[model samples]
Target chain A: MSVNTTQKKHKFNVIDAVILVVICAVVAAAAFLLGSRNAQSEQNSVTLEYIVEFRTIRDEFVDNINVGVKLVDASKKYSLGDVVAVTSKTATFIGTDFTSGQLVYGDYPDHSDVQITVRSNAVINDSGRYVIDGGYEMSVGATVYARMPDYTGTGYCTQIKEIKD
Target chain B: MSEKNSAAKASGKKLRLNIIDFLIIVVILGAVAGIALRFGVVEKVVTKSSLSSAYVSFLIQDIQDESANYFVAGDSFYSQTHSAEFGVLQSNIQFLPAEAYINNEVGELLKVYKEDRIDVRGVFLCEGIFTDEGFLLNGTSYIAPGSTVHVLSSTIDVTLTVTEIDAVGAES
Candidate 1:
């Protein structure tokens, strides 16, 4: 009787061990799949910094211009209104001291230099350069426009300069 | 003699069971770690960079029916070229739209993600420097007060005059 009990206990122990191992294997597999998916999603998205310059055509004392802005590809289908994500760190303004009443006069004021740093995600080629939807390399002076979220009129006013990703 | 043999067998079984239990625990812990790593809960430490803050405002027009849902606080606004920029930093409507009041003095304060024309104000944090134009936040230039900012939206174009700018200190 003792031997029989011992043998039965051993059999139950084996079954429990098998079940535990199987569960662990399943869990590990699931985690691995989830991790792979997360990595792939990260790879599909790229963050890039774009250095933009905006010059004031006229001079007026303004406190600051705080609005949603974008750099669009003018020569491509993007002209129909497509935008990229400008990172908070890169979306900014630079130029004359507005607080002191410095104005941009003449053709373009010497202090009228407005440098905007914009960070966005674009389809980068294997060479790691930004390309439009048609896979055209974003060239220097490609007629890019600085568009704002203006609900009343045409928003494209400033052209981009010195774009460096 | 048979009783002693049986006792020995039982002890061996216990030992084996303990080993299996330990292995199971290890596997479980590993699985948990994997999940945490994937979700960024157990991120690796890296050097931190500096960030700056600025207060900004926008005069947005009436929202169209289709795009009304995208104007809520916390909703990210990207440029037409897929560049993520301003986020909806503030909205008058907190819990319910009916509960909020619109102040016309500061322009029509509208509920977030609602179809209305209103003036929205918020703050953004980014890397910038103090330049001749004003305080350069990110790459956009902030001019002095009274300057006209031509805002171009998909549906309409509007202009907003700069009112105020307060740049916070530089800290990591």
Candidate 2:
């Protein structure tokens, strides 16, 4: 009777070990599938392109200012009237600064791309507006170009390159 | 009496189960589910705001392009404002002094796109002289009707109407 009882106990132990192994395998497979799915999601990211035309925004003549720095600054600066053409497949215009959709640069050639750099202000007010402006002097008739590349996931404006033929 | 006593004694053998063990398992499961909900999935769908903005921006661009075509089909200033000196900068639709409002409208259009995180649409210019004799003869210039001569900025969009033609500078 003692031998018989010992044999029964051993059989039960074998079954328990098998069950434990099965459970471990199931858990590990679940984890691996979840991990691979996550990596796939990362690979399937989407990007949207926006064509911004920076035209002349406002024209002002600096009489007393030095020409070298100020003129160079103007080349890098872009405003509302700048014309930007995006070669991307599609574009959407959310909103703009002017009521009329025409961007004005002094007199840039039609095909030149407008370059714009955005600087963020640290102050926050009751009005939730993200005010960005440029720090450069613009000639009366110099034209500028602009295009905005905004990400679909992150609410951020990406860099804009000048459209050169 | 001996059989009855043995049966009673066998029935008295202790068998114990702890409630804490079951509770602990439940708590672990609840925690794992919460984590899955928060970070494991379902957060990748595009938000409504983004989708709407994309549609709106595209719509505005189309409208502006249509308006330019309409202007082109008339006895407008754009028909006469021709010359290489005017530069390609102002060559999209034709520009008449009166059409300056259309040019200015782009600024406001950008503001609308701004809410949706899109960039400003292209700038359409009316190619014409600020003066009748072309900015050199007399200060007064006449723009052909239905031209893109107006200029606008994003700052002014907050208080201005997109179609209003009042902000444009008169022909020089």
Candidate 3:
């Protein structure tokens, strides 16, 4: 009787181990598949214009973000493309400083919204996500660090559009 | 007895699920969620709900006279930190000489206006939602009075303290 009880208990533990492994494997596989579904997906390359809106930049950098300047990805070191249009306005931000212990709202001093429209070739996916410069993915609100010939700034890819050809 | 011991050892060696295994799986899932949010995959997902309009006032201090010319009314600003509009500059902008407390000859700290510096105060018509945690810019960013924020515009970048907030549609 004792041996039977021991054997059943061992079987139960074996089942538990198998169940846990299957559950963990399923979870890890789902996450991996979902993220990489578009990593290497390439349907076609097209002219893509995306806007990178810099957060807090000085007036000098805004003015210098001129037409025809080339920009590259600061992190991945991939080609971002050339500047096609540059538009700027007043910049606003959720201030990081809370020393006053309250929420403060206001205009960012000496800075403005520098929206640089960069045109480059991107692989368009079926799901509308563009893979730019062969590696970096272009999606709305993706934070990008753009390094220009003479300047560099951090901003979000606020807009993306595929130019029909 | 020896045979039973061998059987038990065999079962143990075959990889039984332990408390540590459950913990490791939980940690892996949590890390995946953290990565998604950190990389901004679901950034716009959380911003779709709860948006409204409001007004924000800010007080900026210590600007040189020449630099103070940049704060203009009727200007609109966009938030760089979040995907939301910062606010529209109202005509209620004002600038005064910046005040500083300095030690006089008698060692008494006297508040006096600095001749070369000016302080700016202004109001903005903003589009956001007001919540118990102050105003949420585009329903994601937070703002409240007394916190210092670096206000960025197309023309200037400066730090300003939030002075007040008023929700436009709370009662409506």
Going through the candidates in order, the fraction of native interface contacts each one reproduces equals: 0.04, 0.20, 0.01
Q: What digit string (tens of lDDT, one per residue) describes model 3 on residues B16-115?
A: 7667467677868888998887554564355544566777777888888787778788888766545456888889788889967554343333457899
In model 3, the Cα lDDT at residue A64 comes to 48
Best by TM-score: 3
Q: Estimate, for each residue in B1-172, the C-alpha lDDT of model 2 and write its tens digit.
A: 6666666566664544344334456556866887766552433233433311000011022223223332322221121232211111222333222112122344322211212122222222223223211121011222221112332232111111111111124412
Q: How badly does each model clash, as a count of residue pairs? A: 51, 68, 25
**For candidate 1, what is the DockQ-based docking class?**
incorrect
lDDT of 3 by residue, A1-165 (tens): 245434334333776677678777877997787656546443376888889988766564555466887776756667788899988886664433334544444555556888889898887666667877656888898988766643455789888888886
DockQ of 3: 0.02
- What does DockQ give for each predicted structure? 0.07, 0.09, 0.02
Displacement of residue B54 (Cα, Å) in model 1 is 7.0
lDDT of 2 by residue, A98-161 (tens): 6555454332211122223322221111242221222222222333222121101001234422
Q: Would you estimate the TM-scores of all the predictions? A: 0.25, 0.19, 0.40
Write down the worst ten-residue block by lDDT for model 3 chain B. Answer: B102-111
Put down candidate 1 lDDT per residue, B1-172, tens digits, no spaces. Answer: 6896777676764335655567678777977987776544543222234335555443333333344344455443433322324323445422222122332232333324343334433332323344432443344433333333554333433344433345554322
**Backbone collision tally, model 3:** 25
